[model samples]
Target: MNVTEVISPTVKCRVHLHVHLDGAVRPSTVWELSRQKKLLLPGNGSLKDLEEALQIRSPRDLAHYLQKFRWITPAIAGDLAAIERIAYEFVEDEARRAVLYTEVRFSPHLLVGPGGQVTARQVTEAVMRGMARGERQFGVTARLLLCCIRGMTENYDDTLDMCTEFRGQVVGIDISGDEASALDVDGSVNAGLLRAEVRTFQEAARRGIHRTVHSGEAGPASMVKLAIDEMKAERIGHGYHVLEDEELYRRCVSTGVHFECCPSSSFLTGAVPLTETRHPMQRFCQDGASFSANVDDPAITRTGLEDEYALLRRMGFNEANIATMNFNAAKACFLPEEEKQDLLQKLRQAYGVPGCD
Candidate 1:
């Protein structure tokens, strides 16, 4: 499962394991959803202004980029049909780009409608409905990864309860949201916050729910190790910062914990420069560190899986290096062994490599 062993990507690699469901919605859909929901666009008072905002230069950092989510979160959360459309449209978008598989993440608590009208189960089911329709219509295999935001403690229990309720429906649990934020959504920020929060993740571990963590992107590499030794994360979301600590990076490579690198999003974050010879993606690959390409927030960054590949290509990654990332992504999925192997077999076939099955 070493990342450096991936086959040459002679064929186009379209398999993605990391994407945010709410952030993958179509731009046109965003406009329509905003209009229907009467959600005021952030920093965009007029249609002209909104257009400019969409094309606005990416914010300075991860925290800064997240500010745009205020408008996006409201538009998709309050309405059932809107959520469904968001899912369906994302799959359709995936199909158009020839992406065969993807794991989409979103927090159900954030999807609560006006007045806390929707239960976590209802919101999850709504997303499932759209996922089902999208899979059927577009021939893409997708699964949901329910995200437990770090700062939102009160709803974490309810969210985890609902996730357990829909156990067979979603693939796994993910610890997500803004780790850089000083306070949780509930206005609590004791130094012991993350220590206490690991309790919820431990519950997920006891229930045998697979876990992945959003760390090492904006945060330090130490956060990545905390997620592994403490949170039981099997893979990492945007863990490019692991390069900062050679020892931790080596540990991850040895243990086979995959790092999902979203170059376009990282470029926006100002953390990892996407240079041809200097990007973290290249560095990780060169060092044989396990990592793969992804679109962290497609709508927020306005990039897709193909564009990410293109970025790597522009950065001097050959076809084989690109294929190595595809192989790493497939092998790193939070799926059952048989399913993971099958997907890897498919990736090998697409890349014209030797079969594993």
Candidate 2:
């Protein structure tokens, strides 16, 4: 849609968090890389065919939503050039969508070669290089968040080490996967794996790295509490289910623990119930909760920050609500205090928030 051409510079000052680098890779890029590498295609092997295969048309559960990655990951995984290209393009896409500042997250272990052909350090450096170039050209500030995938305990330490090594560039850590699959029907997590994940986050907390966890989306409210209490999560990713527990919901609202809300993804992943009643975000808005709108996986969901904001508008969000969310996002961002104030000032100027200037 060439969003860059349409969006005016005045409104291009929003803050975004919770987008995945791998999930946002351009479809055409995936098509070309897959064909060059001779990777299998879904249908006729054309770019259009690959695009159709990469996007999830039918809304499904979290597991089904995640399966779409199989089509794109092989095309870029372990390939340094492809990884860098995707990371660079991600910034361009966000800039077009009016995202002034964004923190893109990914699992470095997943990007490494199947046989350890590339190191995690190399993968992170390639991403940093691409994002740095993109920032220079596009004028959109970008940062990194290294993710630790659930059920992959071996990679937890490496993720932390990478975050420590790239402290300024890599601002925080997250654990993302199928939240439902991570817990049993009774809501208990795997003891050993949970312990390992907790240890990584504890160390991150001790080391002064910011922490966020993917919880309460496909899982129960208890999972959200566990994330904050045990994993030391300062922010939450797709925390729609937090409303399931009144105490937790109240606590979140009172404590101002920011929720990275992905409206389209919440629906596509079946995290929120499809109903005519008010959406969780509406409740969040009415309750004055600390949260921000985000695009979880743009390519897979076939959306961007603009699409997300439009959906929120349809769901009854106003300019003030969106502006407040952006302010919340800026305050919740992992940027250093000085940079954060700068971002807030920019937002205040852009949104014309009174009494700040």
Candidate 3:
């Protein structure tokens, strides 16, 4: 049986909260773009070669996993047309997997390649146009989120500014990148950079921009606490390590901070071990914490939203549990109050879950 046969029997509508726009570029698209731009590809430069190269079959550190971007990113980055095409394609891909709503994220500055003529605003505009067209064509309600890479202190303000400028289309702001590199050997946090990141999130909060931080994926539990307490993150990306601290985990459960869990990506990135008896999300589910399963990087993990649900099933989460997680995702989405309510109602009708609304 395939992924759809396994996942479609139980989980119906889905709300995906954590996925990177750049990381989801279609391998075929990457192949075509690389050929068009005369860019080099691994092996024979065929589509199969590109596909084989993008996937991370061997588990490695976070930094090693990120290096995969160097292959596909150059194809989409600095090219406004490529960015727009991929954005439109992203919606269609998600819609096929029964994702009714999704919030895709990327850093605009990164899209503006080295010495490229395109401005950050233009990059955002292209993505918005593509996604807008996609929404009409594919029937998936899509939103945007700007990302600030950790250690790139210079781009934080631009990310927040874009979130404020594109409030309705761009739903929120996020921070993602190497967590270990941000700390010293003694575990001393990089105070200056941390303060700058905090200031950016504080401004985002004051401007009413929704905030989510990539924390505690490969870092310690303290990063999750800092993301919640100092950065005012409304949701956490990955966040498996939050379970390391019992007090913090209990507090998170009480407060209902959403966790965007990516099972395949977490394993491939070495954030979680293959031989573990229990997964952190199992604890989150048992403790009544709010969390959702997602595909962090389809390009790398070679999985989809349905694949994530299947993984959750294998991890011992039942159909009801998966439905509740989808409901939790709908609740935690960054859409406006009225739109969010509409989404919840749609989910209620789709899942036919009593008292879910």
Candidate 4:
């Protein structure tokens, strides 16, 4: 069969595992929310203003690029209704992109009103309410990962307490932020914070909570090693530098540490080479390193789960490779073994594989 035929036949089976809910809010929706809330705009009071605020150009570092979210927050802040709507919309968009399952991460601590009155527990409840609504509306299954910002280690206790409050709703805890800012080799301000963060991760593991760390996104292989060895991360989010360490790469491959690869975000942030052919995702797959392509920020990157899959196809990934990638995601999911098996079987059946039932 031709490439087109193979891809078309297998598209239904593919699942995108990595997604960020807060980062996936539609820009137009944000603008509408801002207008409804009578929020002031820094620029001209129009959708163009919102777009300009979210627009990220090349050569801008990750920290600077992330700063754009401050402008968009006003659009979604203090509105549980808007949060529910955006959450539903995000899941709907994922379903449209043929995603069967997703694990979305968001920092609940950062979501607050102008008075800073909203507690972390309230934030978690609102997000869970949104996700519950989305699951009911869309067939796509989703689990939330409550993330703790790297620099905000002081809030670790509160974040963990919030996670416990929404225990059933949250599947994991992630330590995510500007990797370059957090993982300094020299004894910097965040060094002690990083050590404490590892202890928090260990505590989470002891409490039977899944843990993943955003490591090596902008740093070296040593950072990735630290996440695996010290933090005991079940998965490494955007470990782009892991390829530099041969031994570490082998350990990851043999130990089955999933790498949540966000192609558009990596390209935009200059972590991975921008060219489709030169993207490290292909090499990582070829080397038996398990990973799944994800839309890190649908709104900011102006791309979705389907766009990432399409990009991979254009980069010469075959249907079989794509199927394997989806399987890797399914296997690495935080869901129960029975649920994972059911999904894997469904995926195999969709691909017309014999004996799937």
TM-score of each: 0.89, 0.96, 0.96, 0.90
> In model 1, which regions exceed 4 Å deviation?
1-13, 42-49, 56-59, 182-191, 273-277
For candidate 3, the 10 contiguous residues with the lowest summed lDDT are: 3-12
How displaced is residue 342 in candidate 2, in Å?
0.6
For residues 51-140, write the lDDT of model 3, one tens digit per residue: 898888889888888998998888988899999999999987887778889999999988898786688999999999999999998788
> What TM-score does model 4 achieve against the real structure?
0.90
Give per-residue CA lDDT, model 1, range 76-125, as digits (tens): 77688888889888877777666777888899888887687777778889
How does candidate 4 score on lDDT?
A: 0.76
Q: What is the C-alpha RMSD of each candidate to the true structure, in Å?
A: 6.0, 1.7, 2.4, 4.3
lDDT of 4 at 10: 26
**Candidate 4 C-alpha lDDT tens digits along 70-187:** 7677777666777777777777766666777778888876776667657667767777787788777767787788888977888887777666666666878888887766644672
Error of 2 at 94 (Å): 1.1
Residue 65 in model 2: lDDT: 90
Question: Whose TM-score is higher: candidate 1's or candidate 3's?
Answer: 3
lDDT by residue (7-121, candidate 2, tens digit) is: 3464667899989999998888898898899999988899888888877776778988999999988989899999999999998888788888999999999988789789999
Off by over 4 Å in 2: 1-11, 190-192, 354-357
Task: Please report the TM-score between candidate 1 and the true structure.
Answer: 0.89
Predicted structure 3: lDDT: 0.89
